[model samples]
Target: MTTTPARRRALVVRGGWDGHKPVEATDMFVPFLEDSGFDVRIEDSNAVYADREEMDRTDLIVQCVTMSEISPEALAGLIGAVERGTGLAGWHGGIADSYRNSSDYLQLIGGQFVTHPARHPDQREGGEADNFLCYTVDVTDLGRTHEIMSGVEDFTLRTEQYWVLTDDLNDVLATTTHPVQPYHPWHRPVTTPAVWTRAWGKGRVFVATPGHSLPVLRDTSVRTIIERGMLWASRTASE
Candidate 1:
């Protein structure tokens, strides 16, 4: 007799800063995950992370919480789950800037958002639009051949260019440079990782720094990359 395979479980943990539109952003991918054969669940708090039973069975986690506090227990649970091979994936401040206070969390993702420098004093006061500027996302030599970046060429985007603090452990796929402006404090232009992945224990982690807003996330290239990233970071993905 033929039997069907068990569906993978995907847990979406979202909610922190609404400006990131955590709910809306995650909602965009829920249907896609379901169609991909995942049994999806959405939780608005980090409490779900501490549920060992659910976490142990989770095949993937898509988190969009930004600049929030995570309890010690919840943080530990999350670390344990990932160390045990539950895939983790996210974009922008959602994952990078999520917990400013947890070093352990930072260690898991391998990167953090320092800032998205504004070009002008006037722009700083105007909001996210003020930080919006034209910039190019250059795919690295390795990225050109990577599954997540395959067929995606160097592309330019008009949005907030993130200045991140990342380590050498990541397998960086794409990068963007923040040019020194007269109004900015930096002496020389600096480049930061825009897309990257990390292998932790048996788990896979994927992060993209470009999804600052829905418009940015909706960009054809950006959307495709993130979709591919989620799949690549899932537990079932081939190593």
Candidate 2:
């Protein structure tokens, strides 16, 4: 008799300003996680961390959180879970730019979204703005060989070029440069890490820069990269 494999579990927490596309983006990732054999739990409330036991058992944590202050207990729980080998993956500012007041969150997540020298990174800065700019993404040394980026193609995104400050230890997968910075208050030419990864304890991190728009996630290259990240980040659980 064949026994069914234990089902992998994932939790998604999302909420913030409407402009971050929180609801819409969270909806998009649900099907993907479900397709990947995850019993997905999409939580509109950030209080999912109230249960430390639940967080401990999760195979992956896909969060769309942005611009909020996560309590210390919640932050510690998340870090501890990942360190115990629960994969952590997300895209854009939703996960990366989340927990604004928590430097501990930023450190655990590997990087933060600082400035978008172009139009707003999500193009919702002024509202009703849809004009786009295209730029090339360069794959770096650690980028080319990582499983998360194994089959990803370096493609351009017709969206806000994110300017991020990343640590030297991060496995940077892709980068894009913005020449429009001269018009802004920031004086230097900006080069953002379009994609990157770093380990938080025993768990792996997979992050992408293309989730700024719902439609942009439709890009063949963007979807491919995100898909790979989910699986790659979840490596510990699968093993």
Candidate 3:
């Protein structure tokens, strides 16, 4: 008799401020993963894993939450699962900007989104907003050679150009830029790493700064990027 491989499961957690668009945005990933053959388990609260033991069976974790304090035990449980090789993937401030109050959290995730230099406090994509920028991103690293970006040509996307960023142990997979304050030390002419990947432990991290809205996430290029990111970071055999 032939043995069947177990189906992979994905844990999707969503919550926090509405501005993050957690509900609508994360919902976009549900069907997407299903199409990929993953048995997705969607949860709106961290309490779902409160059992403290449920993390054992989970294979991948995708956080869509903006900002929500987790119990020490709960936080540790989540991190522990990822450390054990479960995948951790998300976009925008949801994952990168998450747990701002926890230094350990920052260390585990790799980077954070401090600010957007060229972006005004209130603006829309392609509006009359000054310095609003968008450009085609070049995926030159080994990440592009992989199946996720395979056949994905250099694509164009319009996001409030991220002028505020930090450069450390980051693998810049894609980039773009907008002008910032001329007097400041970093007020030079350059585009930044708009999409990147980093490592934490035995696990992996995939983050994209372009998911400012459902429309952007829904774009053909953006969707492919995030999907590939999930598979890349997840602890699945395909990775």
Best by lDDT: 1
lDDT of 1 by residue, 52-135 (tens): 999999999999999999999999999999989999999999999999999999999999999887767865666668888899
Writing each residue's lDDT as its tens digit, candidate 3 over 155-219 gives 77776444425457767777665445543356566676767777766677777777877888899
The sequence of per-residue lDDT tens digits that candidate 2 reaches over residues 99-173 is 778888778878888865555455546553433567777777777787767766677777766777778768889
Candidate 2 off by > 4 Å: 119-132, 185-188, 235-239
Ranking by TM-score: 1, 2, 3
> What lDDT would each prediction earn against the true structure?
0.92, 0.77, 0.73
Best by TM-score: 1
Candidate 3 collision pairs: none
Q: Over 4 Å off in model 1, which ranges?
A: 122-125, 237-239
> Could you tell me every candidate's TM-score relative to the true structure?
0.96, 0.89, 0.83
The lDDT, on a scale of 0 to 1, for candidate 2 is 0.77
Candidate 3: residue 65 lDDT (0-100): 72
Candidate 2 to native Cα RMSD, angstroms: 3.1
List where candidate 3 sits over 4 angstroms from the true fold.
Answer: 1-3, 49-51, 119-132, 163-167, 180-186, 237-239
lDDT of 1 at 78: 93
